[model samples]
Target: MSRRPPDGEAPVVTAIVVAFDSAHALPDCLDALRGEGIATIVVDNASTDDSAALSERRGARVIRNGRNEGYGRANNTGVRAADTEFVLIVNPDVIVQKGAVAALVDAAQRYPDAGFFAPQIVEPSGRVFFQPRSLLAKHLTNPGGKLVLPEGEACAPFFSGACFLMRRSFFLDLGGFDEKIFLFYEDDDLCRRIADTGAALIYVPQARVGHGRGRSSGPKPGLVFKSRWHQAWSRAYVSRKYGLPDPAPSMFAVNALKTLAAGLSFRRSLIERYGGSAAGALAFLRGRSALRQEGLS
Candidate 1:
């Protein structure tokens, strides 16, 4: 992490990109913001790849963690370092569309009661993901373009996690995302809290961000297991924190059956999904809020 700013680094909005071995997809992300005067902060979550250096070369302020601090915590560090009024939190795999930052900033006036602004998120497959419909749908499986908001409906209860712009003060007041979530549902926890405060989470289609799905976790058995376990743990914790009726027992039953079927059919991804649900149910039983680093290290 830099204690000193690199020369005269002046940016209108501080954009924090949380990276974990993200060197492969980072270039395109940075290129989209070239000369945009966005104070880019790349918080490298103990990535072994050259992510920090690559970001530094692109004039981004780099914060290299000694070890992985998870997504929410890493973004918190960048938010703390930000001096700008506006802050954009993004993942390294996200490509910001032209004028997106400005559009989000401009839309802030239209939504005077908003706590944050989310842009249209397009997947590599040309599909929409995590749109406003996802606020209460409670994703049971791959959301894969399942939710859509009509052209006129702009106010949303919640927004996607990949990219969003918000007032720095609003984020600080919420104490940022709950770090206890570790790897998943941190956004859900934060967004719901904002809604509870009677603040709108507006979705602006004019501002768009392209997302490349799941670059960090490749399709491997062990990694998949790690992701599933954490996903389960986080979902359970979020449900409890928000006072949503516990779906643990039902999730466990359905997923256990799915896991058995997937195992028989050799569907590794589905197997992991079911395994995650089972693991989450166990997490709910244990009242665990955070997941310990295990095979992932």
Candidate 2:
């Protein structure tokens, strides 16, 4: 990520863009930021393409990584470089609609106690992305009663990191994101940590961003295995971190059963698609091993 001196004299919001070979969809995103009173920084994670040059030409301060650092680390670099009161962490493949950025800034003021906040995240197909909280938050009590979907009208436990605004100091103090996370589950981990600090994580219904879903995960059996494996690992980590007070062993047992069943089903899909039952089984085994290697069990 790039670093810059915060302009002490004026109120300037710095928008941090984390990109990895993200040239195709950047122009429309930059166009949306036109006239927005915010300085922009783009951290290119070792893109072999012209993404860095394009970002620089589009008036964004660009930082080029030597190789593809994982997502959390790249964003952490941007957070360290932030010099403004707030940092807007936006993904390269997302497009911010009108007033979305401003709405997030205003949300910080409206919910003064919230440490992290996100806008309504809509996929390109208009489906809302509901990144679930830890197992305790989801069950512990009931199913979907306390949970708010589509748009959250109140303080939420977790906020999607795809597009969100957060105070720089608070974000820094919370230690940003866990670099251990390669891709999936970083956002949920951050939100869980922030909420543990007694700082609310809120959702601003007015703010909105459109996501080209699965930009990082290509539509392939390997991608599915890897993504699901990582997510399962992260969920276990979060649960272990926060769900200790509860009957965690029992809860984990329940989830483990479900995950095992799902894994079996997914492995069958892999066998059918790849036409190599042995290789597919091996890939599935690797996915399960990844979860275990990450200490999920």
Candidate 3:
């Protein structure tokens, strides 16, 4: 059932945190959201740990999946379950700063035509993480350039999937994230579609969230390989889908050669990195679906 506030009350914004074995990070993430008095929903993607139970204890509505649905699909589930007009999608490894939610809400109202609003994501070391370039432009035009921080409220090329606020109706209209993506490049795909509709993707620097980047999945080598593999596959898929120059052929050749060298040197991590990309590229070239990749998960 949808959780909505009374008609006369202020518009409610729900925070959706998609968790997968993220018990280590959920407490802080959920606690910050609860502290801000924002309703939160935690979608557990078949986590082997107590992520679901922990979220419930933290006063969050929990949705438990029987099997691991990919990140985008799990987020789609959370967004659908939310009854609010606006929803904040955040990673489990993120701690929402005080007033951040309100800042995003304000930005939403200020930019009525925007389909998405993103908070400034800060790393543990206090470095700001903001990518102002579009994916195509970054790769094709400026391969190496200094990252520039936007001032105040500004239009963004694309917001990071790690943390962002999106209108529920606009999200639903775009059909949410593409489920076929499974993991990586889902944000790029969504942003591309939003651009098609000519809706702005606003970046609100006043809002801030501390992100423990790459900590949600932990440091399991198997998980690392899985992430790398899906990243390559998803990148190839999105590039092809949007008529961008396909990188699968070149990716496959380079990674395949590197994989052979790494295997000869007995470098396990390098083997995983190079071999995963090679396999992913080959899979895409052969018309294999990312979701159907066996033994990776």
Candidate 4:
């Protein structure tokens, strides 16, 4: 049952889900948000599937884009359309658990200085995914650190882009996610900016959500290539933007060699992965636009 706010009180949060070809997982995501009485806006990034229609039928206001606007830009569109004080940015693969939205709102009320509030994300197997580390640690060191679940509300350097609640005014004031980044690392950039402003990125263990990782886009080869390409491009872009060590030079060389080897072996998948990485790095080195023309077919 959907719970309404007290009489004379306005709704506190609106959920924003940016959809590509996400019809498969969108229904459950919308259902979960509706169950919490949260108004949702589905920003359809020119999905060829029935994502927009399904969202509208499920009672979410749908914003249809003419073309794929990538993740950050589409989210910015949704955030701008929302009227609530706080905005819940959720991926189509994430199911916001019962009371999770309420918990995030309560945390926001308690931590007035926080710009972002993230819930504990669990996998289907019940494994908690909570890896919080500084930008330097992420780039300079091995990122596969031990996972220690937070006992309570904890301050994090950065939260996953999968799901989070953020102050609407603060988000807009910061210009939302950097549109220069087509995909990936947008969260890191946002968190860094929030931290620079002396605002907190709080992780509330009381709130939980189930994340079906990488389910937003289907397993098409072109989509996979696009993801890998953007991952490398965005990583290099963020590193350079923040004055971190440039990974492009080394990444390009290593991935180029790997791609050549994979080509010789006729390993199609490896070739795609390594070739995409190499191309992305070279693009970054050449100062090419991050928003490439290639997109999902």
lDDT by residue (9-67, candidate 1, tens digit) is: 64458889989888888888887766454668888988877888999998888988888
lDDT of 3 by residue, 1-297 (tens): 113347688547989999989999999999998888889999998898889999999899999988889899999999999999899999999999988998998888888988988899999999999874656432323346458787777876677889999899899989999989888899988988887888888889989999999977656657757777898999999888878899999999999999999999999999999888888889999989987884224
Whole-model lDDT per candidate: 0.77, 0.67, 0.86, 0.87
Ranking by lDDT: 4, 3, 1, 2
TM-score of each: 0.85, 0.73, 0.93, 0.94
lDDT of 1: 0.77
Once fitted onto the true fold, the runs of candidate 4 whose alpha carbons sit more than 4 angstroms away are 6-9, 134-144, 292-297
Where model 2 places Cα greater than 4 Å from the true spot, the runs are 1-9, 131-133, 136-152, 216-229, 243-297
Ranking by TM-score: 4, 3, 1, 2
Which residues of candidate 3, in runs, are more than 4 Å off? 1-11, 136-142, 294-297
Which candidate should be chosen as best, given lDDT against the real structure? 4
The alpha-carbon deviation from the true structure for residue 227 of candidate 2, after best TM-score superposition, in angstroms, is 3.8
Which residue pairs collide in model 3, if any? none
